[model samples]
Target: MKKDDNAFGVEEAADSPGFLLWQVTSLWQREIRKALEKYDLTHSQFVLLASTMWLMQQGEPVTQILLSAHSKIDPMTTSTVLRTLQTKGLLERKEHTTDTRAKTVALTTTGEKLARQAIKTVEQFDTDFFQALGSKLGDFNKKLRLLLQQ
Candidate 1:
């Protein structure tokens, strides 16, 4: 175990920001998985559903491309998940009124109800998960936003 055998730039693994981010993301996702379990929703499902709900609330016509963009999910995966949701009767996809080539997405009554409930559950989970950051959470979020902008 010679020190020269490794290519790490940091003296300690914990000193690497990317490694720390990966650790935190994994832990956070695990908790989110548990929180969403009661609703029988996968993380991707919850994210797409919630994003659709939000866009609808904003009076935006939710199309598959828009949903994919809003959720930061790849278009193909988004389409597949949406198809599963449609089969489960949680949402519906119809030909867009104005765009013949696109499909619009909307939550059914049941889906809307479920989304509201799941949002509350997830939000509570987030509050608990990030509680350790306390007053620094806002700054942390701003940093994340800055990273996203890049």
Candidate 2:
């Protein structure tokens, strides 16, 4: 094959945004896994737990569907995770007062405490992980939000 005859449009892998994003995301998730080890929570569990606590604080009844949407996790996965959390004694699933088809989720006392603690740890990890971007972090976040909007 010719020196320039490769499948990639970019001359180098480093120039591909998707590739870079994959690499960075992998590294970030690895560290987050380590950070959450003490809490005995996987990243998904922490996300759902924290999200449930946050939504509850807003005085809105948080249902499984709502939590799934908020966390960007699919309904099936959300259900499975919720079941796991319930089994772990971290959360409770109850019939919604108004919706017969929907079940509301709430963190138990232990779950709430663990969620708060894990959130602090994850937030600190994020701060440190993204600190290299420094002042550009806001712009980076905005760009990410824009991508999400797409």
| Each prediction's whole-model lDDT (CA) | 0.94, 0.96
Question: Model 2 over residues 49-137: C-alpha lDDT tens digits?
Answer: 99999999999999999999999999999999999999999999999999999999999999999999999999999999999999999
Query: How close is every model to the real structure, measured as TM-score?
Result: 0.95, 0.96
lDDT of 2 at 30: 98
In TM-score terms, candidate 2 sits at 0.96
**What tens digits encode model 1's per-residue C-alpha lDDT throughout 1-150?**
675456887778888899999999999999899999999999999999899899999997899999998888999999999999899889999999999999999999999999999999999999999999999999999999999888
lDDT of 1: 0.94
- Give the C-alpha lDDT of model 2: 0.96
Please give me the total number of clashing residue pairs in predicted model 1. Answer: 0
**Ten-residue stretch with the least lDDT total in model 1:** 1-10
Off by over 4 Å in 2: 1-5
Give model 1 RMSD, 1 decimal. 1.6
Clashing pairs in 2: none
